[model samples]
Target: MAARVWRDPVLWLAFGFGSGLAPVAPGTFGTLPGVVLAALLGLLAPAIGVPLWAVVLLALIVLTPIGIGLCGAASRRLGVHDHGGIVFDEIVGVLIPFLLVPVTPWTLLLAFLWFRLFDVVKPWPIRWLDRHVSGGWGIMVDDLLAGVFALAAVGLSVHFWPG
Candidate 1:
């Protein structure tokens, strides 16, 4: 079973390139890829002269749909809904805060912490959506909302603290 999961391309991606396969805290491990992706996108600002926020926006636009498809398909294949092994949503979720904030180490750390908090807590609408929605969109939307919560929290923190 594990070998088949590793060999399948869709599962490979939906599982966050094996990060989601971790014995514990798979979401946290899976989010590492998003951090790497966000950092690379940050670099595009100097390389192509594009703004970091714009690049992040474009990345979110592109990745969200792809994540949805991959997540939903993986769920069907596994005969499970939003399995622990499916962390593509987490990978995409962690990218949201970077949309408007500077991609500094401090910001990354804050984003990770805040995103994880919101994801784990699932306050109000996030929890509601997580329970009500189903399939790929269901799995992805809750985390996306958590990302928004993290984004707002991080944005405010950066604004007031300005470190």
Candidate 2:
């Protein structure tokens, strides 16, 4: 399958640097790199005395445009247009919760499951975006919406039990 997606770096990135290559639950596995990134950023942010939330938000701001580019180009190259292998969008979604919620093991698990739920279920507007949006926006917007939902739910938990 390398021939299918090996030609382009953007495709490689959009595939989560090969995390999306898993045969089962590609989307779920594809999110691993993002989780790893969130964990690392959580560790590093405190070293610099920066708030974890601030670091996550900054990553979203910086990486999103790049994700858009990668997702769009990769979709075109794969010609599947939001193929299961194109999971950089899920990473972006997972990152959203990391913006406000600290990346603990429990929180990471919650973020992962919750983001996957929203992404798979695609409730209301999330589904709407998935159906209506096209290209990179199409690929990334729904997952970003999932991230927002996850952020809200996890944010509430963080507030209630901010240990």
**lDDT per residue (tens digit) for residues 1-163 in model 2:** 6555566677788888887888899999998888888899989899999999898889899888888888989888777889998889888789899777788997888888888888889999999999999998889889999999988878887778664
User: How high a TM-score does candidate 2 get?
Assistant: 0.92
Cα error of candidate 1 at position 39, Å: 0.8
Candidate 1 ranges beyond 4 A from true positions: none
**Candidate 1 least-lDDT 10 residues:** 37-46
- Kindly state the number of residue pairs that clash in model 1: 0
Tens digit per residue, CA lDDT, model 1, 1-163: 5686799999999999988889899898988898888788878876998888888889899999999999999999999999988999999999999988988888888888899999999999999999999999999999999999999999998998777
Worst 10 residues of 2 by lDDT: 1-10
lDDT at 73, model 2: 90
